[model samples]
Target: MKRVYAKEDVCIGCRLCEIACVVEHSESKNAIRTYKTEVPRPVARNVVEERGPLTFSVNCRHCDEPLCVAVCIAGAMVKDEESGVVRHNEEKCVGCWSCVMICPYGVIKMKPAAKKVSKCDLCNGRTMPACVQACPNRAIVYEER
Candidate 1:
């Protein structure tokens, strides 16, 4: 399976990817309306990290040996055998936070109000993730190795 990777050297930390992520997953998929009408707004699955002179976006790596899946009590987290994407089944999630504790990348997050966990699913709706498409500087790309 192809995955999203970052070229930190070109990342401008503009957060376009973050914005695009929120909009992509937004209820209506509209940037302006989603912000104005949605209460508290949507939290992005992918996060941008910035240091003194460094910037990079991070999300679920869908690791070969994901500890998150092993500890998920609700069995909501699973790596798709065909795609190798670590998918979180929101309906099956028990909000146990077990995956949150076990993820070495610190990427998994809780949607407390929704009583579910959230992580990157690689945007199955499209060929590429919203973040990758939205990155103006091409700091991010989807590649298979």
Candidate 2:
């Protein structure tokens, strides 16, 4: 199955991906409206890291044999057979951070306001992932390869 991949060499360390992710998941559909709040935390599924001249965004790999799924004691994480996407159930999550610990990429984060672990779900809808759409350098791309 295809997935979103990042080219670190091409990434410019711009946080448009982060902003887009938060806006996409915000209660208010409007991006400008969502930013007016005092908190203004978007909780993006992807995180960008800078290592000198290189930068990259990290997110869920949706691994074929995901350790997060195996480590979730609450059974909050599950993989979709049809789409090959790994998803989380906030209701089922116990906020133990087991999935976070198990994830090799360190992409998962706990949203304190939501009281649940949040990670990339590949958009899973009509719209493509916010990170992919927001990337200015075209470093992030969604494909079947």
Candidate 3:
């Protein structure tokens, strides 16, 4: 399976990936409309973390042994064996922070308005995640290893 990977050596901290992700997941799917209209209030899945001289974008790893899936009290998170992708069920979610607390990478975030937990689902099995596609410097990539 292909997964998103970051090459911190090349990262320039532009954060275009974050912007693209918000737009791609936005309700209107238009960059101008999403920001101008604030439709659905754009949220980013991946975030760039900066060090003194280095930066890297981070998101869900979709681990082989997913702690988020195991800790989800409402049975909202599940791992797919075929795709090695972990998906969250918004309808079943109860806004419990169990998954968020258990995720070692701290990728999961609480959607306070909707009272839901949100993370990267690799763009729900798209050919490539929006973040990877929108990387201006190719610091992020989707690859099989």
| lDDT for each candidate structure | 0.88, 0.85, 0.88
After superposition of all CA atoms, the RMSD between model 2 and the true structure is 1.6
Model 1 deviation from the true structure expressed as Cα RMSD, one decimal place: 1.1
Task: Give me the runs in candidate 3 sitting further than 4 Å from their true place.
Answer: none
lDDT of 3: 0.88
Q: lDDT per residue, candidate 1, 42-103, as tens digits?
A: 77888788898899998889999889988988888888988899888888999888888888
Question: Taking the tens digit of each residue's C-alpha lDDT, what string does model 3 give over 1-145?
Answer: 7788999999999999989888888888888898888845767987789988799999999999999999888989999999899998889999988998999988888888898988898997478889998998899999998
Question: Least lDDT summed over 10 consecutive residues: which range in candidate 2?
Answer: 33-42
Candidate 2: tens digits of C-alpha lDDT, residues 52-129:
988998889999988899999998999887788899998999888888888998988888766689988887683578
- In angstroms, the error of model 3 at 131 is 0.7
- The deviation in Å at residue 7 for candidate 2 is 0.7
Model 2 stretches with alpha carbons more than 4 Å out: 38-40
Worst 10 residues of 3 by lDDT: 38-47
